[model samples]
Target: MDHEDSARFAFLHAAPVIGGAALLKLPPLLGALGDGLRGPLLAGSVAAFVAAYLAPRYLARHFEHRALIPFSIYCSVVGLGSLAYFAVT
Candidate 1:
């Protein structure tokens, strides 16, 4: 496989795993927007997007292949971190 093929393979393998994590992370802020805090949602969503994208990117760099349990844990941990951050300050 060439570089493009290899890169595409990596991205395809990771898409759903990363997507699962990203969507979960987004809900907290998006949910809040629907309930209230509509104005700040743009900022919140951006922050969540950046974090979610970056987290899986970082994890994928280490893991290469996406394993289900680890991806789930990664999502949960990121969600918890987002919640904790919102909780604290």
Candidate 2:
């Protein structure tokens, strides 16, 4: 792909990660704002975002192949567990 296409592709991959990080932080962020803990919360949020962004890149170096298998397994386990829980209830 050309430069612009590559950039778009990168952004497309990144969008979900960025959105997830924001969503994960949103509830606590709003609570912190209401509680007047803006400064520390904002700092912590930035640190969390940076770590989240870098973690995959760091892990990719070690798990070059089969990087997604663990995630898939975890997801499958969670899905099955949720289904079992609801069925029991």
Candidate 3:
């Protein structure tokens, strides 16, 4: 397929990985944390990935030449931010 299609495909693929990991071993996590927090925690983390992946795709759809640069920047910043946030707290 095309570049946009491929990007979207990859973006969709990331979702399951995010959610699955969230659910996996999450029973004990929620057990310790409580029911109220579990849904939001998994949801928020998955949402973060979706937002990070989408920002670049949106910019690239019309921007053409400048697309990849901003996309890369967005991904790096978002990915790194997620990493740091997850690592610290």
TM-score of each: 0.35, 0.49, 0.45
Instruction: Flag the better candidate by TM-score, 1 or 2.
Output: 2
- For candidate 1, what is the TM-score? 0.35
lDDT of all the models against the reference?
A: 0.69, 0.71, 0.75
State residue 75's C-alpha deviation in candidate 1, in Å. 25
lDDT of 3 by residue, 1-89 (tens): 65666666777787788678868867767796676787787887689878876765784575554446677899999999999999999
Q: Which ten residues in a row have the lowest lDDT in candidate 1?
A: 59-68
Model 2 misses residue 81 by how many Å?
A: 0.8
Residue-by-residue lDDT tens digits, candidate 1, 1-34: 6434554577669778967886886677567456
Q: What TM-score should be assigned to candidate 2?
A: 0.49
Candidates 2 and 3 compared: the better one by lDDT is: 3
lDDT of 2 by residue, 5-44 (tens): 4434675688788789879877876784557767777898
Better of 1 and 3 by lDDT: 3
**Stronger candidate by TM-score (2 vs 3):** 2
- Greater lDDT among 1 and 2 belongs to 2
Q: 1 or 3, which is superior by TM-score?
A: 3
